[model samples]
Target: MAAVAGIWLYNKGAQHLVSLAAGALLAMALLRLLPEAQEGLVEQGLSHNSLFVFLLIGLVGFFLLEKLSLFRHNHHHEHDGHDHHHGFDKEEAGRGGWMILVGSGVHNFADGLLIAAAFLTDVRLGWLTAVSIGLHEIMHKLSDFSVLLNAGFTRVRALAYTLACGLMAVLGGVLGFYVLSGFESFVPYVLVVSASSFLYIAVADLIPQINAHKGLRAGLTQAAMLLCGVALVWLLSPAHQHSHSHEMEQHEREEPHALMWSRSVL
Candidate 1:
C-alpha cells in the first residue's frame, strides 16, 4: 500500500523520485546492511577477509546474472507512446521477465535472515533492524513497481506480483528463525550475502541510472537525496550494538531463564 501510494505521488516526477529511491537504497546498503554484516561476522569469529571475499562474490554474481539476462532491473525512457533506449535496455524486454520477481524474492529473503539473526542475537538490536528493514523496503518495493511498469506490466499486475514477492520476506523470516535457531554459524554468512545484495543493487543498478541527469539542479537534487537516504538509515540504526549487547547480558544475568525463553521464541 505504501508503495502504491508512493508511486502515485511520485509518478509525475519519476526521474527525481527514482533517483531519491536509488539513493535511499544505496544508503541502506552502506549505512545499515554492511555494518550489521560486519558485526555479525566478527561475532561469529569469522575473518574479515572471508567477509570481503563473499561480498565481492555476491556483487560479481549479480553483475554477471544481469549481463547474461538471467536477471535485470528494467530502466526505460519513453518519447511519446514509444519507448526510448535507456542505459540498461535498448529494445524489447526479454522473456526472462520472471527474473525481476526472482531477484526481489532473493533480496527479501536475505533481509529476513538478517532481521532474524539480529533478533536472535539481541532484542533491541532486532527491533532496530526490523524497523530499518521496513523503511528501506518501502522504497525498494516502489522501485520494483517502476521496473515492472517499464517492462510493460500493468500497474495492477505489477502490484500483485510485487506483493507476492514481498511475502518472501515472511517465508525467509520463518526459515531464518528455525534454521538459525539450530545453526547460529550460518548467521554471519547470510548477513554477508544480504549486505552484498544491497551493495550490488545500489552501485550497479541505481547510481549509473541517476547519473544520467546531467543538469546542475538535477545533480544537486540527487546529491541531497542521496545524503538524506544515508542519514535516515544511520539515524535509525542503534547507536551501539555493543552497548545493547551488554544490557542484554545484564538482563540475562538478572533473569536467565526468562531471557533464554525469549531468545528461544525468536
Candidate 2:
C-alpha cells in the first residue's frame, strides 16, 4: 500500500502530504499510545522495578539477537546495484534481511498490543509510552530505509516500505484492543517481551553498525546519542519510573553555559 501510494504519487505535492502524515502518525504513537501501556501495567499491579526489569530484558534480547546475527552467512552481490560497506556478501545480508524483518515485525506487532493495553488502563500512560515507542520507531524506519535503498529499491519504494512497516502499528494496536479483552491478564509479560525485542535491535544491531562507522571522534558522538536516547525515554517515563531523574537532573545542572556558538565577529 505504501509503495503504491508513494510510487504513483511521486511528485513534490504528494511528498509533502506523505511527510506530513508521517510526522502526525509518529506524534500520535508517541504522545498518545505509550503512556497508556504503562498505565495498563500499573493497573495490573506490577511493580515499577518489574517494569524496568522487563525493559532491561527487552534491550538485552535485541542486543543478543544482533550478536547472533553477526555469524550470518552471505555471498557477493550488489544491493540494488549499489556498493555498500559489505561488497562481498550480498546474499548473506539478504537472508539476514528477511530474518531482521521477521524479528522486527514480531516486535512491532507486540508494540501495538502493548500500546493499546496501556491506553485501556489510562490515557496518560498511553501518551508517554507512545512517545517512547515513536523514538524507537523513527530509528527503526531510518535503519530499514537504508537497507531497502541498498537492496536496489528506489527512494520512493523504500519510503513506501518503511511506511507500510509503520502502519503495522495500527493493525497491531487494533488486534491488541480486541483480542486482549479481559485478557489484560498478560500485559507484564507482553511489555517485557516488547521492550526486550526493541532493545535487542537497537543495542545489538543498530548501535554496533553505528559504532563501526565511527573514528575516535565518533565515539563521543555515539556515546552522547546513546545517553540522549535513554534520557529521552526516561524523561517520558511515568512518574513512578522516575528512578533516574536525579542523575539526569544533576547532569542537566552541571552543563556548561554558553553552549551555542554563533558566528565570530573577530
- The 10 consecutive residues of candidate 1 with the worst lDDT sum are 73-82
Models 1 onward score TM values of 0.68, 0.53
Clashing pairs in 1: none
Model 1 C-alpha lDDT per residue in residues 119-217, reported as the tens digit of each score: 776665566566556544665677677666666778799788888887888888888999899997776666666566667766776677688879899
Clash count list over all predictions: 0, 23
Off by over 4 Å in 2: 1-81, 84-106, 213-216, 240-266
Q: Please list the Cα RMSD from the true structure of every candidate, rounded to 1 decimal place.
A: 9.4, 12.5
Displacement of the residue 222 alpha carbon in candidate 1, Å: 1.1
The prediction achieving the highest lDDT against the true structure is 1
lDDT of each: 0.67, 0.53
lDDT of 2 by residue, 1-266 (tens): 33243334433333223223333333333333334445556777876566666666655665565467431111112222346664557677665555545655665666788787666655655665565566545445555555666655567766765676667778899988887767767754665564454444444444545545547766555555555555554455555354467778777766643233232332
